[model samples]
Target chain A: MTQPAISPALPADWRDFFALTKPRVMSLVIFTGLCGLLAAPGSLHPVLAFTAILCIAVGAGGAAALNQWWEADLDAGMKRTAQRPLPAGRMDRESARDFGFGLSGAAVAIMGLAIGWLPAAILALSIFYYSWIYTVWLKPRTPQNIVIGGGAGAFPPLIGWVAVTGDITLMPVLLFLIIFMWTPPHFWALALFVKTDYAKVGIPMMPVVAGEKSTRRQILAYTVLLVPLSVVPWFIGGTGMIYGVSALVLGGVFIVLSTEVGLRSSVPDDAMKPEKRLFAFSILYLFILFAMLVADRFATIYGWQA
Target chain B: MIDDPRTHDLELFRARQKSRNRVLGSILGALAVLFFAISIVKISNQSHKKAEAAAAMAGQH
Candidate 1:
């Protein structure tokens, strides 16, 4: 007797479902949100604080899922994103959609009930912004997509601050702006090398639409704008010298890298060394900058050395 | 029977389903604990606020 045929595709497992959440990107969201919560003046009950961060993380995950669901085709076209669960055919679209909506709804509901409706509302808006505004609309249509999409990522810190303070303030708004301005240089650096994959998918990334020269110039411009903005909280007396000095030092290295990237002429078959360095350093820069914000706050509380 | 393709497929499917169920159960359990803790915190905070207000009123009177 002939052996029976076995299905080549395995059923989607929990790990595949988890990958739909884009946990790597979600980590950045959680870190910035946590820093915002920690840096804010007032204290929330530990439970409420945990809930607020949970909501932010889950909501970001939900948005990421919806993005994959919507962009599965586009993702499949790109070498970089082709391995994602939906793109790789590890998961079905309906499961992804249901999971996204379910996670988003639960996160908002828990946030509203446990924390305030205000932060919950912001969380909901952020999910919508990332899923619909960025992923569905701007990304396909415009070269400046990530610039506006920055707002979606920027909401975490603002939401984190508002969760504790229960209102918007200059400080929180500055925190939002810091992330907003930071997004482009960080993303465009990555885009500089990955432009080919974006071009394959017709996504109109900055580098694809504007070319490497313009993209590198814009990266340097955004980095220059970001350094001053990161230092603004200290200038306004919102943070102490710890953050201000760190901003200057970190921003100094950031400028050096950006300048190197911006000034260099691309060689044919080049490795994109400067752009890659800037890209990696940009992530580390933001993580350290936000950590300093929290550290400065604690120093104020405990009278530690700045 | 052990080498049968259909039986191997069935085993893998069952394993995937089992893993998904376990994850779902863990999430539900964590959520239950989270909600309960939120309720307790909110109740205590509300009562403390009420007591503070009542004491202030008494002092004014």
Candidate 2:
């Protein structure tokens, strides 16, 4: 067998560097950040809120770029990521690394100056958590990687809350927990479908290391935990009954999907159906939950706080 | 390494340069759109608040 080349031709184009940032993922992060800002009780200048969201987006993008840079080798081996900018020889490793670092640093500094030091500090911590702790240390080491690394994705809403309030509270923490618990089920569903891609790349995702049965069981367990957790914001009065009802309905559907994924074995070719359904519903679940939070806030303004 | 014939393929080099420029242009263009959208929203919000205040004063009279 011929030896595979390690580093290929470098893409001199700047867009290749941009591709490393994962703009699609950044959009969700920015949206959650905006929701956090809008739902907070405190007031913020419009410009300042915009600045905060921008910084969150940039910081998320930067962390993503760093992740791609670090995982370029693994990416090359995985069919799903084989065509990524770094792995496809569309960008050089050193350049991607530098771009990630520059964006992380600049985002933190701009946030500190334009917003406040607290939010800026949180932004910096999130970047470090994602780029260094999650991507570098945890991801390749253990199957529990996504569990602990999920905190990085969960931080945006908390950062958005802090951007307005300049402090942490139980409400923001609840919001963080909602996303924290939501991450595993959402990602693992995708992982179930993509296990082969991960295994081919030598990455030890839960499905690869523990087998499909265990991964399915873990997904169900997380979904069970997530249902109760999603309803907690309403119980604690951070949100109202509109959110409570939405959470209950959405969470119920999520658990049903998870159970189906767990119960079915030797699924027909199309019967991995539950996994795809769960993945699609998971996105809608989070969106509806956050949208309810915003809607409930407006309801309170209109004398429907309950 | 510097004298490689592949590096001196002028047409390929020009094509790469053109693609790079186009990508950069699109990114800057998107950023411009985002900036203007945010600016317009802020301006409209301020105007709405002003109108609300004026309406409240008229009602008080």
Tell me, by DockQ, which candidate is best: 1
In the order shown, the candidates' DockQ scores are 0.60, 0.14
Query: Scoring only the second chain, what is candidate 1's TM-score?
Result: 0.96
Model 2: CA > 4 A from native: A1-11, A267-271, B1-61
Q: Write one digit per residue (lDDT tens) for candidate 1, span A74-181.
A: 999988889998888888899999999999998899888888999999899999999999999998999999999999999999999999999888999999999999
Candidate topping TM-score: 1
A1-306: candidate 2 lDDT, tens digit per residue: 532234334347766776788988988898888899889988877867887898899899899999998999999998888999988887778888898998898789878876679999999999999999998999889998999888999999999999999889999888999898999989998898878888887778998999888989999999999999989888888888888999999999999999988776544454577898888889988888888888988898789765
Docking class of 1: medium
Judge candidate 2 at residue A76 and give its lDDT: 91
How far off is each candidate at the interface, as Cα RMSD in Å?
A: 3.6, 8.7
lDDT of 1: 0.92
Residue A125, candidate 2: alpha-carbon lDDT: 93
The sequence of per-residue lDDT tens digits that candidate 2 reaches over residues B3-52 is: 64554454456677789888878867976775676567667878999999
